[model samples]
Target: MGSEKQGFIWLSGLLFLNIFVLSTADVHYYEFSLQESPFTKLCSTKIILTLNGSFPGPEIRVRRGDTVFVNVHNQGNHAVSLKWEGVKGSIDGSNELIQPGRNFTYKIELKDEIGTLRWHATSAWAAATVHGAFVILPVATEDYPFPAPTSDQTIILGEWFREELTEANQTITPGSADAYTINGHPGETYGCSNDTTFEMQVDYEGLYLVGVINAVANETMVFDIENHRLTIVGQNGTYTNRSFTNSLTLAPGQVIDVLLLPNQNVGHYYITARSSSGTHITNGILRYTTTTTSF
Candidate 1:
């Protein structure tokens, strides 16, 4: 992933792609509905706007050079704006407001781009829940720039607030979240979250591709897993010289791709995250598959 400025919008009933001219490329189409969903966290249930009823939403997966068309239905009470400033092709997929009950479509071309990126609401506090990963895999003719892992997962780090979202038109300030979350759970470290903490089940010696995104409202997060080394292969969508580290510092909206090879004893380990300068901690569990020891 490198420079990505070629994303364009196809307006319905107004603008359309010249299908005849670009019929050879693959097209990926998706529908996203911004609906009101009840979200309960830290022992309180509140109504929040979500994409397809999911806090972290869904991944927009496509191959390099493929075109993606996302048709968004804004069913929430507030207007929405989505932004995706990705790599290499720099597909700055920023759009004007899609008012309540209105629908719009977004066209993104991932030409010459590969790796991890993201899209999130840019209007007021909508991004707190309406966000997801945008992944561009290598084109059909090419393989990954690095060794392919046996499995893959996406870890989205986000902040949570206990305060009920204000008016739909108001921007709720994220003044030091009530807790941080991994893939939507506040982990088990918080009160009333023990049973809901996210978990990763892995083989004892599996090699995995882990995509980490710092989606905290406004904080830099440091992420680490106990007894495991994160072999960073890419940062912000571009491949980098392989580097190993125990802790990774990620600014808001930054993405990291790492290879996690579990070589420790087959039990459980802790995947932890916290603000770079905060006292609170969030933790997820990494459990290795269990089996008879052939004793």
Candidate 2:
């Protein structure tokens, strides 16, 4: 048997791909509501449209061959619909549009072999906050090609705009965002008033899996962890020929799975995401855990 525990993280609209081995197929039910909530970004706070009152919403997990039914309700004034990215089939062969004060049910089947994907509102600007991770696990008969890691985590890369996007004639052009964020925070380096940042703890000589999700609305971004090399394992829910690189490039709505083997000197390292065409940068911390440290 492999490691049974899984971890999830969200950035703007990014979703982590973490596959598990399951014994049987099952049906999963989920409720998603489109509404508004007060969110802080780039040193400012405002009410933004959201899914289930969260910026990045919730994580959906299922086994291969499982069926998932998501009931989405639009509480806001705008019409909304959700589209699953990297999915093999359509949304029951129909468009899933939920108007204001209306509800729609989305039926999706996990027919793909295995990988990470995401679900987001098809309506423009709604995806700015209405998105989440969709994870599909392999069947119990299958196992990962590589050795299972001791621990795992996810990193979601995204952008944040300071102005309201619901206004008329608003669009996400280049330079529309005030800053970028990792797991919904711009980190202390960006002068975020909240001073919140994403942190990953590791142990010496431990192998870990890091799922990277690029949910940036408009720009391709680069991801790197200081003093480490990432071994590419999968992309967009499909395993690929393994490779190694110091950094990764991801366009919007792309997901990559990488293996992190921490053999360097134990300390804190910066996990950075920088926009390829813009000056926006966000950061997280990767801290090595010692016997005396709890994080």
Identify the candidate with maximal lDDT.
1
For model 1, what is the error of residue 46's alpha carbon versus the real structure, in angstroms, after optimal superposition?
0.1
Extract clashing residue pairs from model 2.
115-237
TM-score of each: 0.86, 0.86
Q: Put down candidate 1 lDDT per residue, 1-295, tens digits, no spaces.
A: 1223223332331233333223446899999999999988888888988899998988998876688889999999888878885644444435588899999888787655567888899864778788899887665555666777788888999877777564453564444578888999888888684337879998877789898998876788999988999899887766788999998999888999999988888889999999877856899999999533545
lDDT of 2: 0.77
Q: lDDT at 64 for candidate 2?
A: 74
Clashes of each: 10, 1
Q: Which residues of candidate 2, in runs, are more than 4 Å off?
A: 1-23, 167-170, 291-295
Q: What is the Å distance of residue 197 in model 1 from its true position? A: 0.5
lDDT of each model, Cα atoms only?
Answer: 0.79, 0.77
Clashes of 1: 10
Instruction: Give the 10-residue window scoring lowest on summed lDDT in candidate 1.
Output: 1-10
